[model samples]
Target: MTLSRDKAIIGAMEILSELIIIALLSIAGGVIAAMLPFAFPPAVISLFLLLLLLFLGIIKEDGLSSSSSFFLKYMAMFFVPSGVEIIEYADLLSSSWFHIILISAISMLITFFAAAKAVEITERLMQRRKAA
Candidate 1:
């Protein structure tokens, strides 16, 4: 009983620490974004900073694994607010429904084409490497 209790406590602490690290990085990203001359989303800046840290070996994947898993587990919850906002702005969305659908369709096609080309390039590169 004691052993299981201790393990639970340790696991909770680990998740807390991982969340703190992510929060600090996000705050730092916000500050950096504010200091920039051009308008840029702070969240994108945060993601880029996190990527840089990982690439530089300043942060290990294992360090964030728990928090990342937690986020993924509750990912649907994250979209709840967006859904609520859409409901709140249903009138505006209805008014622009046609434009929204057109833009969404165009963007989806562009994204699909880009992803297909990327995969083709990657496969060709891999095949060449195997041949070499």
Candidate 2:
């Protein structure tokens, strides 16, 4: 069964969860850095902490709402801004890098298959556990 429309969107406004927590952590780190007379960007500080949390397996995916996951799923598009730089220096990806492109394509295909298999295995395990 899927979540109802209202329930799915309820967490969207309650920033008390993931997004707000990351923002607060970043802000606190920024303040600490400023107080210590260190020279570090606030955004970078927050992102660093977020990565640390991720590494320690703190933030979870299951607790995230469908709407938040939707945004997170598409957020990779935000990298398009930096991706535009590839066109700014298009010559860097010319015919000389054809092998690189071919290898990258193959690697991406492999990664996709691997991730799909892993998810399938995980689902099977969960199903078996639930049945038991």
User: Which residue runs of candidate 2 sit more than 4 Å off their true CA positions?
Assistant: 1-45, 48-81, 87-90
TM-score per prediction, in order, is: 0.78, 0.39
lDDT of each: 0.93, 0.75
| lDDT agreement of model 1 with the native | 0.93
Indicate the residue-level lDDT of 53 in model 1.
Answer: 91
Predicted model with the maximum lDDT = 1
Question: Residue-wise lDDT of candidate 2 within 11-48, one digit each (tens)?
Answer: 66554476677568868878867876668787777677
Give the alpha carbon lDDT tens digit for every residue of 53-73 in model 1.
Answer: 999999999989998988989
Query: lDDT of candidate 2 vs native?
Result: 0.75
- Candidate 2: Cα lDDT at 80: 87
- Those runs of model 1 whose alpha carbons end farther than 4 Å from true positions after fitting are 114-132
